[model samples]
Target: MKTAARKTRPAFLDAKRGVGNWAEATEWLRDRGIEDIECITPDLSGVPRGKMMPSSKFTSNTSLALPSAVFRQTISGEYPEETGDFRYDPLDGDLKLVPDLSTLSAVPWESDPTAQVICDIHNTKGEPVVYTPRNVLKRVMQLYTDNGWRPVVAPEIEFYLVAQHEDPDYPLKPPRGRSGRTITGGQSYSIAGVNEFDELVDDIYDFSEKQGLEIDTLIHEEGPAQLEINLRHGDPVELADQVFMFKRTLREAALKHGIYATFMAKPMQDAAGSAMHIHQSVVDARTGKNVFSNPDGTPSEAFFHFIGGMQQLIPKALVMMAPYVNSYRRLAPGMACPVNNAWGYDNRTTAFRIPNSDSAARRVENRLPSSDANPYLALAASLGCGWLGMTNKIAPGEPSYKTVNEGTTIDLPRGLLEAVSLLESEPDFARIFGQEFIHTYAGVKRGEFETFMRVISPWEREFLLLNV
Candidate 1:
């Protein structure tokens, strides 16, 4: 039996004692008269799940036993009764949740001054549960470290903010073009765009600074209401945490101002889709030099192997990259979306693009994943593919230079069914993701596809129903 190796150590173990631990966290709350705590753990779908505890019961010593089923719940948030009759109640064979003191952070949007902590679920035997998303990421990180390489990542997240609609019955409208009244505007990297959204952007910067996130830049993208935020590169684990927190913070901040923010890949079929393009490289653990860079100012053999790994495993990992039925709509050729499992030097048409920058910035950018994906799962899939590439020495194909919109072709999975089938058929991915996770994820997504197939859309009603 091949046991999974432990990767990066838990942040709680190395966290500064007087900074964010439970004791200091409690004192920080007491100083502000906070009377409530929002204890949460990210579910399979990346949604936070947990209960609010009163301040009196949320002391430093407070520890709750959560059920292992919380990690296996369906998209609708229900557990399978057939599996040991799992329920949210304490009497239902609950697992342990020892507070991860390092995750304690203030909930900036809450009026009562609440703090939130991300927890790790453990079994009765005090073993780390394998089913948890955090654990999956940890295991993958360990693989990288064991290989004598440190993975560094920075995510470029693109999203939109729209006007709030008061009427619940109002029909959804298509996103207007670049000419529409936007919160900001300009050519791709304009300072004027920042000026338009100055206040909101400032709030985001301030909030991130307080939370100790190393945010780099905020820029307005090509789409009318689109904006992108970049975080400084760091260890892959910390980078993933930053991605999770950044999305949560953006949503919370948007809600306070009565604006709607969405990370949906393609909110408008006519416009470019939003992507969470990941920039990644492997570094020498001791010297801190990027291992992917070569002396000739080109990618090293290891870099090609890493890219090959991505290409080989991407078909199987599509479900993780594009989690929803709607996500498939964004994978079409052209419109700045990648259609083929190919790589290029400074080309956006390819699935993986190597930016034409200096050796320091020479890294692969995977363009497949959307902003709505679970960050941990996406990172795991990417890392897994890269690892497989290195292990197998998979050769990367040639570069694609033509624009996807100009009829430049590469074969991509046509629809959700194809993607799901690809994932199910790949043995390499099955080995890494494990049987339980693969079944649960594929089952939920397949269920979603079935639901979507059975439903009639507005397009069908407007054209097919009337014409046919």
Candidate 2:
């Protein structure tokens, strides 16, 4: 890969400073006649957690206050026992949510004309909250900035769109007439045969464009009713925002068309699973040069170190990458999912792949993560690993050239328990993700896993009923 000359852009040129302060935000709201605002913060599992507020109060208030204990709440809305009596006091204390003004946007698809703003959690004393996912990513970004590096990321998201059944008690409804039918056959990127879903795709594209989103491409994926959408590369924070918005937009668009969209990694037992493949690189902040470019235009040492860090931390970060119980079902070999921790050039079978492209376009593609991952956590984990590798000068092991589908000899954690155990024991994970946060996350996930284990499956009932 040959290094290409980098183009320069003025500093602060692209900064989104649409709403500078509460006063301006309020005036803007008044002009637009917007009456409601949603102050959203990403929780432990990357789900939005916050309250809807009257537009006047939301824009006029100097600072938005929330309970700090909301961070400690379980994804299912329960308090963890570890908090003991501390949780009650914290719930009563105020944690201010200062708006990230750049994130203010109107919900184009919402019928009631709502506005949204992403927030950074702060203690009542005005300091940044340590455990919040946004704060975690911000810390990681600061580390990169301190090292004179800027991370650029682009993510490819895969999801499924299914017709919403007419009745909850009835089986899934067949598509309306022959033209509006869903894909029953597993077609691997057949553009000609995918015209049946053109209406849905067109709607999605229109919706995304209306929201000022930059979606580069959309195509049919390997599974029936599965689709992949790719966004252009940008700064890590902006990329994560795009991911969050993309999921929301897809769901809203689907619902408008009388369909449902899911980002679940594996919805069907035998179907190909959805994945979120992330492409990443580092650039020099001063010169705007790509630091990952090698002298010969191949992947540079920085790039190798980044990939090495990802490989080292991947096993431990599985819980973050694939948070749900069903996420593991997509990791089987030969199914286009990564079952082993390996890297290769132009190889899709390996967990990490350097796609065959010109030096200017070279990037590492991490294929292990499912569509269910929280973008903030995923980016933080990747940055943490990269930071560690850079600081320690860790070299990556030799690349595995063997095809992953043929079952290369490398071993990966077999299940969620193994994944969680690996994460808990990783040396620097506690330092990157604070022990308190890690413990809380582990407890919540473990509870979910235990509940899943106690359930009797349909397969078990069918097999035992006749055999016994």
> Which numbered prediction scores highest in lDDT against the true structure?
2
Clashes of each: 1, 1
Question: Could you give candidate 2's per-residue lDDT for residues 1-468 as a string of tens digits?
Answer: 999989874323332223666656766666667778888888877778787888877866647777766765655566655432122343358788878877776776777767788888888888887777888788888888989988888989998776675553333322341364556646667784356667767778877765557899888787777889999999888778778877988898778777788888887666788998988878889977788897688678887888788878777887888887788878776667878778999888888898887877777888888998888888887777877777677788888787865754436676777777787889798787766567666766665676667677777888997998
Model 1 stretches with alpha carbons more than 4 Å out: 1-21, 31-33, 74-93, 165-187, 294-298, 408-410
Tens-place lDDT per residue, model 1, 263-356, is 8877766666788889988888888888888777767888999999998788778778788777777777666788778888888877898887
Give candidate 1's whole-model lDDT.
0.73
Candidate 1 has which clashing residue pairs, if any? 7-142
Error of 1 at 188 (Å): 2.8
Q: How high is each candidate's TM-score?
A: 0.86, 0.88
List candidate 2 stretches off by more than 4 Å.
1-18, 73-93, 165-178, 192-194, 408-410, 465-468
- Whole-model Cα lDDT of every candidate shown, in order: 0.73, 0.76
